[model samples]
Target chain A: MSRPALAVSALRPRTAPGWRTGLLDSLDAVGAVVLSPVELVGMAVVLLGRMAEFMLLAPFARDRFAFQRLIFARDLGDLLFGPALRVLAICVVLGIAVALVIEQFATGLLSQTGTANLVIVTSLQQIPPFVASGVLAARGALPLAVRLAEMVDRGQIDSMAIMGVDLVMLHAVPRALAVSLASVVHAVLAMVVFGVTTVLSLAGLGLVSTGTFLTALKLLPVYEKISLIGLQLLTASILVVAVALVEGIQGHGEERVDLARVSMVCILKAATVVLLVNLSFALSRMPDLPVLVWR
Target chain B: MRPAAPVDEAAANGLSVEVRGLVVRRGRRRVLDGVSLQLAAGAFLRITGPAGCGKSTLLQTLAGVLDADQGSIRLGGRPAATALAAGQVAAVFQRDSLLPELTVLENLLLPLIAGQHLSRRLAMLRAQVLLAQFGLVDIMHAWPARLSDALRRRALLARVMAVQPQLLLLDDILAGLDSAGRALIGRLLSPPDGRVASIIATSSRVDDFAHEAELLLTLPEGRISPSEPGQEGSGCDTRP
Candidate 1:
C-alpha cells in the first residue's frame, strides 16, 4: 500500500505577524542601526584600554615581557619595513601630482608666499597622513586582519587560549602598538618626501624657487609638525588598527569565502573610519561662522 | 622517549573533570543537548560518534573554547576556565592548531614561554626534548605548512604536550592518520610513565583508540547512548 504524502509547510510551525509584532520588529531594526556604532566604539575603547594596560604592566613583569617584546619587535619591523618601498613610490607620485596641480591652479592667481602657504597646507599638513593611512591600511592593517581572521577561523586563537596565552597581550597589543608607531613614521616620511618632491617639481616647472619653499617651511612651527604626527597617530593608526583587530577577532567560519567577505568588510569599515576621523578633525579646525546679533 | 616535564607546578598533577547537564546550541540546531560526563584524574575517556555528531563541539566546550548555553564544568575541583588559565588544560583541535607564522620549534616554545612564563633557555630545552620525543626533531625548524599531514599532527600534539597539561583534550587527533601514525599517537597518549594525568579524545570510529581508553561512550546527535557491553568502564558513568 502507498503511504499518503504530507505537506512540508504543515510540519513547520508558523507565526503570523500582528501590528505589534511589526512595530516591535521595526523598533528592533532601528535599535540595531542606532546601537551598532555605539557598540563598535565601546569595543574599540575596551581594546585600547587593555592594550594600554598591557603596555604599562608588561615592563614590571619581566618574564612575560620578553615574549611580548619579541612579538612587538617582529610586528613593528613588519609594519615599518615591509612596505617601505611601496610607500616611497606612492609618495613620490603623490608629490609630483600635488605639485603639478598646485602649480596649474596657483600660477598667476597667487604670489610665491601664497603658493608656499598652499603647499604647506595641502602637502605638509593634509595629504601625507591620508596617503600613509591608505598604504598602511592596504599593506599593514589588511594583512594583519587577514592573518588574525585566519587564525580565528582555523582555531589557532583557541589553541593559543588553551595554552594560556593572553590573547590581548600576544596579538592585539603588539599589532596596535606597531601600527600606531609605524603610522607616525610613515606619515613623517611621506611628508618629507612629498615636500621635497613638490619643491623640486615646482622648481623644475619654474612656478616657485627652492628658497621660497624653504622659507615657507621655516615659517611653520615645530608644534604644527608634532600635531600633524599626533593626528595621524590618532586616526590612521590607532583607530584603523582597532577596527581591523575587532573585525578580525570576530571572524567566523573557515571557508575562503568567509575570509574574503570579512576582509572586504574590514577594509571598507577602516576606510570609512579614517574618512570620518579626518572630517571631524577638519571641522574642528574650521573657523566659526559669523552669527547675527539679535536685539 | 618521554616528552618534557611540566613547566608549571600546578600542571604536573591531573585534572578531574566533572561536566553536568551541558547544553550548547549552534544557530537553530542543538549541537550538544544536556550532555553529562565525568572523568577522574589520571583516567582516559574516549568518545566515539558519527560525523557532525557534536564530538568536536563537546571537546571544545570542555576545553573552554566554546561556552555552553547551560551547564557547569569543573576541573580539578576548580572551574574549567581557571584550570585552563593555570595551564592545567591543553587541547589539540580537529584542525591544525599550530601558528602558521611560527616554526615547529617556535610552536612548541610558545606555550612554555608565554603561558608558563618559562625562561627562554628552559623553554627551548623543553621544546627540543618534545620535538625529539615526537621524532619531529629534523623538522623542528620547518614551518607548519611545509610539514606532511602526519608530521603536522604530530607537531600539534607535541606542542600541546610541551605544557604537560593536567587534562588533555584531543578532538579527532586520529582522524587523517594511517595505521602507523595512529599507533604512534596512541602510544603517546598512553605512555608508560603516565605523565599525562587525564585525557578526553574523540574519534569517528570506536576502534580508532587503543585499549588505553578506560571508558568508551557513543555520542549520537549530541546525547550519550549506552555503551556497548565491553566498552563500559567504572571510570566514566555513561548514564545520560
Candidate 2:
C-alpha cells in the first residue's frame, strides 16, 4: 500500500466511530428541522405540477369538462376500494388498541382527570389520521407504483411518449388526486370507524356513559377537524406523487428485483413523510387542540 | 400566432435527415461516436450493424429520444428536436409500444385524433379503411396485448403510417416476422410512388434487403460507412 493509505488504514483501526462523523450527523439533523418548511412547500409544488400535467394532456384531456368529472368520479371510486379501505382497517385497529388501554386499566383515574380527554382527542384527531396516512402510503400507493414500474419495465411508458401522450398527466395526475382525495375520505371514515369502536368498548364495561361521551366530544370546534383533514390530505397527495416518481416512473427503467427494492424504499419514504408532517401539524395545534373526540 | 392549417397539408411536405458527428453515451460508454449521414426525401437507407453496436441509439437520436452528447442532427434544415416537435418523425422501437387497455383500432386512432378533428363516425370509417388496407381489418377490435409479436409490430407500423410522418424510424422491429411479413413491410415502407424518408436498423443479412433498399449503410465500430447493395465478396462479418 502507498504511505498515505497505510497511515489512514492504521488510523481507522484505532479510531472509535470518529467525532467528525457524529458532529456532521448532528448538524444534518439541525438542518432538517430548520429547512423543513421549505422542503414541504417544494414537495407540494412538485405534486401540484404533476397533477396539472395529468389534468391538461392525458387521454382524459380530450374529453369534455363534464366527462372529466365522470372520470374523476371513477378515480374516486377506485381509491375508496383500494387505499381507503386498507387504511380504514389500520385506523380501526389503532382505535381499539388505544380504547382498550383506557378502559381496562386506567378506568377511574383516566375518567376523572384530563388524561382521559387527551387520550380521546388524540385518538380521533391525531392517531387515526396519522396511521391512515401510513397505511395508504404502503397499501394504497403500492399497486400504482408496481403498475407504473411494470409499464416502465415493458417499454409501455416510452410507447405512450412516442405517441405524444403526456405520461405525467396521464398516469401521475390521476393517481395523485385519487390518493389525496381518498386520504381525506379515509380520514373521515377512519375517525367514524374508530369513534364507534372505542365508544362501544368503553360503554360495554360501563366505564363511560353515552351522554357524557357525546358532550365531551362537542368541546372541539369545526376548524380543528377541518385543519386535521386538510393536513392529512396534503401529506397524502405529496407522498403519493413522490412514491410514483420514485417507484413507478424510475422503476420502469429497472429490473424486477431492483423495482421491488425501489418500491419498498418508496413505501418507507412515504410513511416517513406522513409521520413527520402529521407530527408537525399536531404540534402546531397542540395548545388549542380539540377536546374528547371519540364521542 | 398563425392560424392552424390542415394536417395533411403540412404532412405532404417531405423532411430530409442529416446527422454530423453524433455521439450518444449511456452511463459512461459511448454507444454512437462521430456518426454522420445524409438522407434525401423519398429515400430508404438501411443500417446494418452487430448487436449492441448502437443501432438503436442512432435511430433514437434521429427520432429525438436520447439527446446527443456531442455533435448535432438536423432534420430538413432544422434541429432534430424541432422536427420532432413539429410532428415530422415517428419511431417503431424493438419493444412493443401498444397500450394494452385499448383495442387495436382505438390505439391506432390516437395519433390520427391528436392534431386533427374528426367526428366519431368519420374516425371509425377512416380507421376501418386504413386497417383494411394494412390487412388488419379482422383484428381491429382485438386487444393489442393478445396479438402475436409479428402482428403487434404490424399494428405499430400501421400507426406510423396513419400519422403519415415525414421521417420514419424502424429499430429492429421486424425481427420476429416471417418472409411474407417482411416483404409486406418492405413494400409498405417503399411503395411504388411514395416519397417518405426512412432509416431502418436491422441485423438481417445484407442480401435480405438488397432488392428493396436504395442506399446501404453499415455501422461498424461506432461509425457508419457506406457499402454496395448486395455486394457478395467484400466480406465484413456483421452477425451480432
Candidate 3:
C-alpha cells in the first residue's frame, strides 16, 4: 500500500551532504496518519517507540542519579515557570470569566421538581475543560515551538544522533510528558481559581450562596471527568509536538537560513494546530463529552 | 599523548568492519549498489568520492545509524546495528554536530554518561584527560556555539575519541583544517596503537592523509575501486 511505500521512502538511502533528509523521513510517518487502519496502527507504534526513546533519554529515568534528576527537574521547572505559567493563568482566568457570566445570567428554573434538568444544564465539569484546554493551548505551545525550532535550526539534533543518542528520547519525550503534566496542572489550577472566584464574586454580589454552587459539582461522572481531562492533555501535547517537529524539520538548511524567521513560523503553525485540535476534538466528541461529564 | 588513563584492554582491541553486497536505494535511485568491502582491526580505509557517491551513507552504515537495504554489515563478527547499539561504533559528521547548548566538556563526557553510565567524577576525569590530549583544555567549558569552526571540529573529533568506539567513522570532517587540526586528525584517527579502527571519507583532494592511509578507495558510479597505496587486499573488494 501507499503507507509501506512511504515507510520505504523514509528509508531512502542516499543523503547528499546538504539535504536534511532526516527531518523529511520523520514527516513520512506523520503523513501516515491519513492512511488505512493497519498503517495508522503502525504509525501509532512508531510514535510510541519515539516516546519510549524520549523517556529513556529523560534524565529522570530510573537508573539516573540524584544529580541527573536534579538537572531534569530544573528543565521541567524552566518550562513550567516560563510558558506553563501563562497556560495556568489563562485557563483560570477563562474559567472564572465564563463562570461569572454563566452564573449571573442563568437563573435556572430550579423549581424543586427540576433537579434532573439542573444536573444536565448546570454541570461545571464539561464546558470548563474545553475552554481551559483551548486557552491553555493558545497561551502555551508557542514558546515551546520556538525553542524546538531553534534546536533544529542549530545542529542539536544531529549532535544527538552522532552521539548514538535517540533524538526523540533526548528532546521530544521529556517535552511531551512535561506538557501533558502541565495540562493537568492547568486544569487543577483552573478549578481552584474558578472555585475561589465563585466564592468571592458571588459573596461580593450577594447573589447565590457559594456552598450550593459547589454542591451541584459534586455528582460529576467521575470516570468520564478523569478521562476527558486526560484526553485533553494528550491531544494538546501531541498537536504541539507534531507541528513543531514539522516546521523545524522542513527547514533543512544551516547557512542562509533565518532561525528566528523559522521559529516564528513554527510558533504560528503550532498554535494553529493546537487550536484546531482543541476545536475539532471538542466538536466531534461533543455528544459523549457532556453525557459522561454531566451524568 | 596517550589516553589519560590506561585504556580498557577490551576497548583497546580495535574493531574490524565488513560489508557484503551493501545496497542503499534513495528514491528509486541506487545510491550505494552491491558494495562489498572489508577492513581488519587497526586498519585504515580512506574513501574519496565526488559529491553524491554515498560516502556519508557508507560511513553512516558502518556507524549503524542508517539502515542497509539489501546487505550485511558486521563489526568484529557482530552486526553493525548491534555493535552501534552497544556504543562500539562511533562517527563524526562534517557538521560540527556538537550539542550547542552544552559546554565542550559536557559534550565530550556524553558518550561515557550515555553508554557506560560512568559516574560524574569518572566521566569528568576521562573527559578532561581526553580534552587535554586533544589540546582542548582551554575551551572545555565554552559553549559549542561560541567556538570557532576549527576549534569545534577538534572538539568533535576529541568527543569521538572519548567514546573509544571499536569502529570510528569520519565523514569528510578533516577537510579545510589548518595543519594543527590536520595533525589532530592524524593523531586521533590513525591506528592509535590499535585502540581504534577508522574510516575517513573526504571529498577534498589533499595529501595530508596520503602517507598514513594504508588503503584508499574511490567511489565512481556507485562502485568502490582501489585508489593509491595499491590493494591492501584485506581492505578491498577483491572479488572477481
Candidate 4:
C-alpha cells in the first residue's frame, strides 16, 4: 500500500526549528555551568544523587524506566541539561550546606568520609529531595504552567478560565502537584534507608563506642525523625505547589515556540525554593537573632 | 395538540451552534474580541483570513481545544464545550496533531478513548468504516510516520469524522494539499448527504464548493468580510 508515502509526507514538515534550537540552547547552557570547579562539583553531587535515587533505588517506582527509542540522548541532553544543571547546582549547594549543619550537630559524622564522603552523604540527602521537587515541579506544576503559559502565549488558557474549567483543578494544582508529592514521598523513604545505614556504619567501625551508639539510637526519638520527614515532605510539596501556582499562572509563551522560556521558569522555581530553604536554615543559626519557637 | 404526531421535520435540524460574546486573549493581545457567530444544521461555511488573524484560534475555541475568554458557546442548545468534549464535535487542526506512533485506525479512536464512552472493539469497527469510506482502508494498520502527506491529511480528517460530531471545525485543513487532493478532502468533510454542520478555514485562491456553502467570510488582519456564494464547481457539497 501507499503507507510509506503517507509516512514520508507526515515527516515532510521537518521537525520544527524550535525543537532543535531548544536542544542546542540547553546543551550550551549546561556546557557553561559545568566548566567551573565549584559548579562541576555541585553538578556531580546533585546528578549522582539523582542517579542513585532515580536509577539505583528506582525512586517513583520507576523500575521499568527506559527512555523511548525516539527520545534520543541528544534530545534528552538538550531538553534536560539546562533544567537539570540548575537542579544540580541547587542540589550541590544544599547538600554541602546540610552536611555542614549535620557535622556541627553530630561529631565525626564525616571525619572518615572526607569532603567526598560529605558530598556523598549530603548529596544523598539533598539531591533526591531536590530532584524529587524538580520532577514534581516539572511534571505536576509545569504541564499546567506550560499549558497556561501556552494559553497566555496563545490566549487559550484565559479563554479557558473565562469558560470556567476550574482553573485550579482543571489546570493548576492537580496532576503535576500530585505527581511531585508522590516523588518526594519516594525520596523520603530513601532518606530513611540512608540514615539507618549511616548510623549502623558508625557503630560497626567503633567510631562511637557500642554503648554510646546504642544510647544514641535509643535516644533518637521517633517523633523527631517523623517531624524531619514531615518537614522534607512539606518543603517538597510547597516548592512544587508554589512552582505550579506561580509559573502556571504567569509565564506567557507560545506552547510550540517558547520551550526555552518554559525551561527557564522551571529552573527558576526549583532554584528559588532551594534558596529559600537554605536561607531559612542559615538565618535560624545567627547568634544575634531572636529564637523562633519552631527552632 | 394535533394527535401527538412524531414530527419528522423536528428531528432534522442537523447541528446548531450559537456563540455569543466570545473573547480570546493571548498575553496582552486579544485575538477574538466579543466575536459571535452561528451555524444552522447541515450548513457549510468557509472562514478565510490572513495569517495570525485568529481564524485558527476561533476554530480551536469552537472545538473545545482552546477555551474562549468571556463567552457562551452552545451546540444544540447545550454547552458546546461539554458536548464537543463528549464526542459531539470533531476538529482538524492546522498542524498534523495526530499521534506519530499510532496506526491510522488507532488514531481515529483516540476521541472515543478520551470520552471513555466507547469500547476499544466498537471504536475499531467504526474506525474501519471511516477508513474504508475515506479510501484509507489499505493504510488502516500503517503508522502515521509512513503515510503520504495527502494520506496523512485524509487520515486526520477521517479520525475526527469518526467521532460522528454534530459540529465539525476544519482549521486550515488544506494548507499543504494540492487542488485535486483538496477536492477529495473537501468532499469527505461535507458529504452531500452528511447532516453535520461544518465551518472550514482556508486561504485558497479557488472558490471550489460555493454552491454548498451558505456563507463565505474572509478575514484580513482579524476582520470578517463576507463573500457571495457562487455557482456549483468541480466539488460536490455532498447532498443526496
All candidates: DockQ: 0.29, 0.12, 0.18, 0.07
For each candidate in the order shown, give its overall lDDT on alpha carbons. Answer: 0.70, 0.62, 0.57, 0.51
Tens digits of per-residue lDDT for model 2, A1-295: 0000000000011223568767876786799768755665665577787667656765554532222344356666877776656666776677678778888778878776445545675557776667666666766567667766666665555544554544444445566777777777777788788877777777776777666666657666534468766765666667656655655655312133256776786677677777777888777666554333323
The runs of at least 3 residues in candidate 2 whose Cα sits more than 4 Å from the true structure, single-residue gaps closed, are A1-44, A50-74, A112-118, A150-159, A222-224, A251-257, A289-295, B1-13, B112-128, B135-141, B178-184, B187-199, B204-212, B221-240
Name the lDDT of candidate 4. 0.51
Question: Chain B alone: TM-score in each candidate?
Answer: 0.85, 0.81, 0.82, 0.79
* Per-candidate alpha-carbon RMSD to the true structure: 9.4, 10.4, 8.5, 13.7
Summarize candidate 2's per-residue lDDT along B51-119 as a digit string, tens digits: 767776677677665667788888877987676766667777666467665688977776555333345
Question: In model 3, which runs have C-alpha deviations exceeding 4 angstroms?
Answer: A1-9, A12-33, A36-71, A88-124, A127-164, A194-295, B1-13, B18-22, B33-40, B69-74, B77-86, B119-122, B175-180, B190-195, B205-212, B218-240
Kindly report which residue pairs in candidate 2 clash with one another: A53-A169, A54-A169, A152-A252
Tell me each candidate's TM-score: 0.83, 0.76, 0.66, 0.54
Q: Write the per-residue lDDT of candidate 4 for residues A1-295, one digit (tens) a residue.
A: 0000000000011233687777977786798556533543443343334334443433443212221112223223333333444444554455445544545654564343233233333334444655555554554455545654554444433322222222333222233334434654645544454444444454444343334433433332433344544465455554554554445444322245365576576567656665565345334333222221112
- Provide the lDDT at A144 for model 4: 48
lDDT ranking from best candidate downward: 1, 2, 3, 4
- Scored against the true structure, residue B42 in model 3 reaches a CA lDDT of 58
- Give model 1's docking category: acceptable
lDDT of 1 at B31: 67
**Of the pair 2 and 3, which is ahead by lDDT?**
2
Give a tens-digit lDDT track for model 3, residues A1-295.
Answer: 0000100102423455444676776676677544533542443355556666545655455433322343346545755555545645654565456546645564353323223223332334444455455554544445445555555444444444545554433454455556666666666665566556655564455545555555545544434557766786677665665555554444332232366776676566556656665666556545654563444
